[model samples]
Target: MEHHIYIIPISTEKLEMTEDNHSMTNEFILIGFTDHPDMKTLLFVVFFGIYLVTMVGNLGLVALIYMERRLQTPMYIFLGNLALMDSCCSSAITPKMLQNFFSEDRRISLYECMAQFYFLCLAETTDCFLLAAMAYDRYVAICRPLQYHTLMSKTLCIQMTTGAYIAGHLHSIVQVGLLLRLTFCRSHQINHFFCDVLPLYRLSCVDPYINELMILILSGFVQIFSVTVVLISYFYILFTIFTMKSKEGRGKGLSTCASHFLSVSIFYGSLLFMYIRPNSFNEDDKDIPVAIFYTLVIPLLNPFIYSLRNKEVINVIKKL
Candidate 1:
């Protein structure tokens, strides 16, 4: 069997060019926070601060969920998983990103870059599912309060979390598998600090029709599926609120989904802006900033959102 490996046509002279030419052409430079050496310290400090906050916030949520049995409902269970996913996703990118910001090398080997992307995509996708799961849990608890326990049982909770991990990782495997079919050309400079699918796609010399289509379809589905879940859950929640004769009941109903509502808006808003629109409309400079909200800021915000909104979480935290 023969496989046609597509490649960019490098001129014979260019391929056999001087060492300097190859070094410049073959090198994959990372676009870190800044190119200036003096900026390294500033970037390191800023990113390091953000990274610390993310870790503390997520780890603390994990702890709160574990120690508080009273908080051991499907909502909190899914929240704990979301916290874990957020922490992992942030860790997957931020530490190396912060390091790259400071280091002189500022170049990741092709394999290393690919590996980073593999996990980054995996964790982020998992967060999407996890958040949706949290929404469903809220829906059951609020809209179907009488049957909440029966609907969101321990077994079902475990399966949803398990399914999310399974789904997210399976999604990633599909992408990495697709990438394996493509070949890397001499171009190695990754545009952003950490490896991302879009940058890698641009760098490939091969026809990426298959990979591009898969991403478009798969990403669209993840967006639509998760958003639909959130919307449907909230719609029922709103209907339940309308039916509630007690003002207290209605307030409680809306409050349960508020954090999730804010989170969904932020995450999906950026995603829709980035992937849902025309190809030529990309705000490339806004990529990192957009990434910051979902990747870094959202993780930091998770624990705060849950704790501030849920008296049980705050009370539990105070107890410890």
Candidate 2:
């Protein structure tokens, strides 16, 4: 009697186990600045403070927008949504990240990771759409002031906000769904603070070509299309502002856009740097700072950026 032996590849074994959801690693150790143990306390304090302020600032703006009858316009509605999404973005990341700073066991379960990434994705994606919507609002207000009210109707504003959320939901769902197909077997240690998709790809035993391609296509399209809208709208706005006979009109136009543009530039710049590149996987050092900027700092800054420069928000605050 002759016996034949067949050996399965280790990668294949890992993939099979992962598919069953009982892989060797059901939890990932988030190696977030753990190397810098001396700085942990300071970092935690700083981030905690930032997180508290971010929540207060963003939610306060939302509340103010809701309460103020004069702020029932299209611009404030978009600003309110932006503030809400910022709060979501900060809340999704900062708590877990802060927890990890002191946690002896910084392991996060698969589902927790998914939830974190989902909310973060949703917030960021919706933010892109919201910014674009705000740009279009500015364009209509500045370029075609005569038709502003007619063009940016309440129904249209609601539809645009609804569309942004719907797109965000779909994008997050698809991305998380794709993550399920990946088999993380190489190492269970996530290099960054959270369960970011790119870091997970680095640990996958299977080729993540499809996942990467989808990110490039979907995220690329979202960023590019939204950015195009912003740029074109701003171009038209600039043309109109410069062509205006009244210095007051030009000043008003620039004032109205300054805050939104600053916010958009910082938000999109960080995003573009983080995701829209081929060698992103190799950029660990650069990634952390950029991620912090977008996920934490941007949210912290946005409320102040929009509010301090605006006459209406200041008046509302004074009345409060």
Best by lDDT: 2
True-vs-predicted CA distance for residue 320, candidate 2, Å: 1.2
Question: Scored by Cα lDDT, where does model 1 land?
Answer: 0.79
Cα-based lDDT for every prediction: 0.79, 0.93
Candidate 2 local lDDT, 169-262, one digit each (tens): 9999999999999878787988899888889988999899999999999999999999999999999999999999999989999999999999
Query: Where does model 2 exceed 4 Å of error?
Result: 1-24
CA lDDT of 129 in candidate 1?
Answer: 90
TM of each candidate vs. truth? 0.88, 0.93
- Cα deviation at 206, candidate 2, in Å, is 1.0
Candidate 1 local lDDT, 53-152, one digit each (tens): 8889888888878877888878788888888888888888888888776467777765666677778778778888988888888888887779987998
